[model samples]
Target: MNNKFGLSNEYTLAKVLQIKHYTRTLFSFKTTRPSKFRFKPGEFVMIGLILRGKFIFRAYSICSPTWHNALEFYSIKVPNGPFTSFLQKITTDSSIIIKTKSTGTLILDSLTPGKRLFLLCTGTGIAPFISIISDPETYIKYNEVIVVLTCRFSQELRYFNYKIKQLLKQPHIESHAKNKLRFYLSTTQEPYPYSGRITWLIKSGTLIADLNTYTLNKRDRFMICGSQQMILDVVNLLKSIGYIEGTINNPQDFVYEKAFVN
Candidate 1:
């Protein structure tokens, strides 16, 4: 199928390898990777399908690690979303289009070396971090890796919880993640052990208290992903503590990216 942008040569056709639905509004799928496709962990690429003869593409963060044989994506099913409404219906062997180039700011290379790495995310924002944490380089670079995931309901966190467990069981990754990895889960609308937005937790010092470790400082690095409002709140909180924004050219204390364009 030809892309609506008329750049067919810039797109690669890939077949869906597997699909798993976690909830009515959430699902994940894996697709065959092109031999020439190469992307760093925590990057995103455009993906879509032809609908009524017109191609519809959306930016999606790749959830699988760079070493993985197939590309994986975790997505939300927006009721009337242009791409998701049809994307949620795709099955194994379904044909989809993946843009040749992948790029994003939420990458390990964008941050300076630090002792501890914190990955803060909400909703599908956990996608990029999934790839980051799964990569062996993450564990080798930092002494501690903490992933804070917050969602409206407990069910929304199931997929990540399961994925982390599976990743821990892997022979190659198990050693690095065993004592170094920490997963913190919280829910806002639903009752959970940890409840409330992460910004509030940081403000109240409860997050630091619960972790029972050193406070945020130059020795620590942070990566954030989520909604615009959430990102704004977290960024403000980090800035107040003297954390600076980072990029590929300017390595700093923290880096972030939007889970989806709003």
Candidate 2:
């Protein structure tokens, strides 16, 4: 039997505050956050629903900053996909099941002190970075933040780009965002500019060349989220260059998370 909004023992119900559809397959929604619920900028939590008394959930990275009163998530609509398909039914009047405890390898604590932080992602992998980039703590931790994203189509990039642009316009952070944050965007299936350089943009030095920034130094840190292959490719390249991975993250010169939600 379904309660007011499908209750579950391990999860709390959050009312949907708003929803925005960026594309036919891509959408973002906000939900009320429980006062005691807490998570780091890059953490992900289980979100889903209880159907027929069975709980179905998937890991979704929190897209909003830690200080926000509401939690936000960006999702891709996979046709007939497990959670995505079921998720299509929810609306502003709906309530969702959110596991209180959140966890992930992409948190800032995993990385040692560094001067430059590179956030590399593809497609919806950009979710966690959104929170990371907007967090004031991230600005305090690193002098510069560079975000690189690639997808098959330009529309797939609207979320990250829009969020970054929006952040640049905000009042207090405007100066820091403009002076410290940089974005490189591109589309693989088509010709568009992003941070990627050479045949493998994430692993190449082309971004520094294009940006006229300082060369890659040991003080630079990296965080990656994307397909498994993309993660492996970037990790291998970083390790080959002697970048030590986070000891907390199975030893990578970088930290990574697989966000294959589609």
Please report the TM-score between candidate 1 and the true structure. Answer: 0.95
Each prediction's whole-model lDDT (CA):
0.89, 0.81
Model 1 per-residue lDDT tens digits across residues 1-262: 4444465677988899999999999999999998789999899999978898787888899999898889999999998988898899998858799998899989898899999999999999999999998988999999999999999999999899889888988889988787999988889998888988999888888788888877777889999999889998898889988999998999999998954535
172-220, model 2: which lDDT tens digit per residue? 6676576788878878776676534323763566777777888888899
Q: Count the backbone clashes (under 3 Å) in each candidate.
A: 0, 9
Best by TM-score: 1
Model 2 residue 7 lDDT score: 62
Q: Cα miss at 202, model 1 (Å)?
A: 0.7
TM-score of each: 0.95, 0.90
**lDDT of model 2, residue 237:** 85
